[model samples]
Target: MDTRFLESFLTVAESGSMAEAARRLGITPAAVAQRIRALEDEVGTLLLSRAGRTVRPTEAGSAILARGRNILRDVRDLQALAGRGSIAGEIRLGAISTALTGLLPTILARLLAAAPMLDLYVVPGTSVELYRQVTEGDIDAAIVVKPQFAFPKTLDWHVLRSEPLIVLAPERIADRDPHSLLRSEPFIRYDRNHWGGRLADSYLRRVGIRPHERLELDALEAIAVMVSKGLGVSLLPDWAPPWPAGLSVAKIALPANAPERHIGLVWSRASSRIRLIQALQTVASQVSMDPIAG
Candidate 1:
């Protein structure tokens, strides 16, 4: 397929008019029309159907549009690979909330220091959303964690080893009788939909350690605050940011059946940025040294 023709077709799809597409491409409307005609002739299909002053895609046009975006993405990747420019481009990364505290600093601090001219964009969300962004090529890379994490053949996921979940409580809080205290007070619940939350929930279920669900909270700091106030008991990753003042560690035995979750960095081959991917891998390797933290 002609690269020029694909470019023109995409421009038309974006502009929804041959004249507009030609204007954006800095070419005559006739030239743009010729490129589309050339593309349609090669494909042996009617790609677009006219609708008054506007244009709409035929069934074939919609299918070709999808492929065209992918083709453009590949072209961009190739150009980057061939370029000799410094690592000065924008790198967009999405991370789970708490993961950013340690993991991102380990990775991005180096990147920013190495490439002072680079523009860094960091978006924090749940792990599941980060996975979607990577798959869509919307972000360059992401850090994902969960027990059932598996890579599709088309995508890639690198494990950073398992991070054990630990219970954080007050200094004198009931460590062995967490359930007893929970029944007496409110039990702070982490967001069950998140990776940490779900993993903690799984452990609770496996051990049959049920607490009265008083509060459903997500943020680690917030949970620590509630726990410090003697509101409840909570389970969290042993490897976490600093706890609030007065908060203490509450050790919970790993259930015989429940196991620690493996933390990983996942990226889509379709969207992986070489520098961003490398930075993430380097950080993961460094963090793997800590046995308690994920």
Candidate 2:
């Protein structure tokens, strides 16, 4: 059976009239009818029945239509795969702002050097938004702090880095005991919905330490800034001195307990970019291990 005839027959069945299908296919109505007859002859069965100006599928037409749809879908997929042999298109990668600042550039540079034709588009958003985009297939993949949320069973996750959490206090207070620091100051907590926030909260609760009942904020940089101002103590991954230049890092160790933050790559198992993903993963692991991320 000719695939062209199957396409014409399918189009007629969908549009319900030869005139409409021909108009859509930019063919004459008589040509559409001829193709339909040829398809019927090949199958040795009637495909469509006329009802005034409209057409309805016969039993054979319904069967052929179902098979034709599958055939067309496979044809389109084959075409797509054929054209996707090169990594020469835009790649939209999303990450948390912190990750964007810390790790994204490194990965993008590696990706560009390896796949020169790829135009990288970087989207910086909260972990929650990035997770949704990854789940919905809006983003090709993501490099964000791991979220404490339900992931679809179809996704692949890789733990790229596990960063040690630290206490952010004034330069003068850096040497003080962490328990005393946490107890004496209003701990400016990050928003609890983020994975990092929830992880910090869980760790604090487990350490038998309670943050002062007052201040809370969301953004990492903002919390860092507040900690620098001596508004309160904050706990975050040990990356750098917080804002307000004079700030410094002090590592905190609890009895048999230490808080950790995870950064990782998340991608769909059904995604078409597996080779590119593997390449990115190879480079990303290196980026994750860089001393700058510390």
Best model per lDDT: 2
lDDT tens digits, residue span 1-294, model 2: 777688789889977999988886678999999999998998899999999989989987897777786775455445435547775554557888777766777778887897887655566777788888787766668987776666779988888777777777766677788778887788888778787888888888877888785577778787776676668788777642223344453456543457677888998888666556666788888776777654
Error of 1 at 233 (Å): 0.8
List ranges where model 1 is wrong by over 4 Å: 1-79, 82-88, 115-118, 147-149, 178-185, 245-258, 287-294
lDDT of 2 at 35: 95
TM-score of 2: 0.67
Q: Residue-wise lDDT of candidate 1 within 1-294, one digit each (tens)?
A: 888898788879767999988876778999999999999999999888899999888889998887887886676566546543656555567777666775667667766776676655576778778888777886677777753556676677787656576666665764555445544555688788777789888777866767777788878788877777767777776544544556554656444444565667777765536765665577567765654343
lDDT, residue 173, model 2: 71
The number of the candidate with the highest TM-score is 2
Candidate 1 local distance difference test against the native: 0.71
Give the poorly placed runs of model 2, Cα more than 4 Å off. Answer: 1-84, 240-255
> TM-score of every model?
0.64, 0.67
